[model samples]
Target: MGQALALREDFDGSDLRRLARGSRDADQTRRLLALAVIYAGGSRAEAARTGGVGRQIVRDWVMRFNAEGPEGLITRKAPGSPSKLNDVQRAALVQVVERGPNPKVDGVVRWRLLDLAAWVWDRFGISLSEATLSRELKALGFSKLSARPRHYAQDADAIDAFKKTSRPAWRMSARRSRPAPR
Candidate 1:
């Protein structure tokens, strides 16, 4: 068997436990507690069990702790794929959205996500779903807004006058519906 791993002499079990308690991250707290157990002469396997991980994981943690201290115990984010649309394209898209669509050229008065997706496909050869296009537009600070539909010949003044004058004959109806007295 290999030689045992050594923890820093300055830190004891209590100090490790205190650090664990102070940590906001649960994983970091668990790793600190595991290291505390190891510092108290517990085996790597026991430390792994305490930390809820495999023995190899405990070994890795110990190495990180030795090299980088408590800061190294925290988890890091995984790098994902880059966005499909580049900065220049996104900026252009924003300007186009701000300008609105041309009814004569685009065939539609409003820019629907479906229309935008089709435009993107035609302009850049990028196939985009309506939902994806919507999400991208929202991320660029655009919100869904549609004008209320009304007939072209509708008069707002007439509608307001009708609302003011219209009243159901509730008093006559109530008198007619009264039961005959005994």
Candidate 2:
């Protein structure tokens, strides 16, 4: 039993209908049409029916429209969860990755996702899973790359010396022919 919200007087039913016609967003257009019904002296129930939404939703649309005009009716993507790393932490992470790990100090020849996660936990006190760390790395423009494994005792020169230099030439034998009309 609260007082009914008033629609903005600047735009009338025809203006809303025209805006709806030009709008690219289907949801915005639908909302505009519904509000247009209200502007045309139609009941909230009628507007709701036109919009294919409930009366409460129509009321919300009216409030949004009143505050922000036609632009407010457009649906927007929801803001997702905030990043775990702040700017300073992210910069530090980037620097660590670029500088590479020291085997003597960090106990690793190359950085793995597990090692990175542990490093983050130790440095930032933030526990991140391997997958989450990988995702973060990827978002920060890092790709997973590993050098091909080679045996410690393998000799490159010996391998080159055993390799075939050229293809072996084949010798063809002369073929005997039969009489054509026999």
Candidate 3:
């Protein structure tokens, strides 16, 4: 094999062990301990055995440690898939949702997740599933809200009149059914 990579001059075996002791991340602690072994005059193969990784990974760790110190060993969250909608498209979607759907033009009074997904496909030519669109909408600070169903022909005035007339009858019946206090 070729010559082993040099560890950073600033840190020694004791410093690495101390850092490992203070580290909250388990992976970072393990990496630091393995590097500490190398710093204490252990071979790359021994360090790899200590880390439970191959010699190649131990070399990579050495490189990372040399470059960025202990912090480089901490694991980072992976960035998942890119958003299907850009800022302009997202803003337009927000505006469309806030403005509400038109029954005549959009053929729907209320917007469903599927309807919004279709609209996104039609307008931006990007296909998004309802669940994915819902997640996107949630990320954009939008929540699903649906109004309680009401009959189109229901009379508010008649309902109010009935409520006004029914209460006195209900109270009278209740009074008649209750026994007199001894």
Candidate 4:
């Protein structure tokens, strides 16, 4: 024999339907909601069982509509605004700071943050603060190496002699791949 019908809790489904009907969410949500009202309980109470949404979701929609009105139904707040520097600009900045500004140009071995910032401003026309420039270079895959002093002869022949005999650790022949064919 069929059991007696389950008495629905005092919840009135019309309240939720009325609120959902006037909401401003994209038409799709409104349509789904009409169906949910039936599935939830107003008509059949099947929507709540299958949609995984609590039957109280209908009440939530009504309450939300009352508090914020319509547009509150849609979700928002995605992330925004990425870095201003593009890949090539970032790469050039990193290369200039980490490896460019050779001794011939800067008159010294290492790069300085202030100098790098100036160089970046000149090249990219975007003035980068010193701390920002440092952080950017690091972000672009470069790291700082501490500076050390070096003394070298200006004369090519003197430099050659120094390389060959004075600085035994720096043998030029070791750097040469092989003797050219005769």
Best by lDDT: 2
Query: How many pairs in model 2 have backbone atoms within 3 A of each other, for residues 3 or more apart or on separate chains, i.e. clashes?
Result: 0
Q: After superposing candidate 4 on the true structure, give the runs of residues whose Cα lies further than 4 Å from its correct spot.
A: 1-81, 104-108, 153-182
lDDT of 3 by residue, 1-182 (tens): 69989999999999999999999999999999999999999999999999999999999999898889889999879999998889999999999999999999999989999899989999999999998999999999988888998999999998887774434444345676889999
All candidates: TM-score:
0.68, 0.72, 0.78, 0.37
Worst-scoring 10-residue span by lDDT in model 3: 164-173
Of the two candidates 2 and 3, the one with more favorable TM-score, higher being better, is 3
lDDT of 2 by residue, 1-182 (tens): 88779999999999999999999999999999999999999999999999999999999999999999999999999998777888898889999999999999999988999999999999999988898888888999999999887889999999999999887798555555544576
lDDT of each: 0.86, 0.93, 0.92, 0.59
Q: For every model in order, what is the number of clashing pairs?
A: 0, 0, 0, 3
Instruction: List clashing residue pairs in candidate 4.
Output: 39-45, 39-46, 39-47
Which candidate has the top score in TM-score?
Answer: 3
True lDDT of residue 49, candidate 2: 100
Summed over model 1, clashes come to: 0
Q: Write the per-residue lDDT of candidate 4 for residues 1-182, one digit (tens) a residue.
A: 53323323433456446656666655425634544455354543455443356656644554454455445556557676566578899877766665656788776556788877777677888877877877777776667777555566457577677674444565556546887779
Which TM-score value belongs to model 4?
0.37
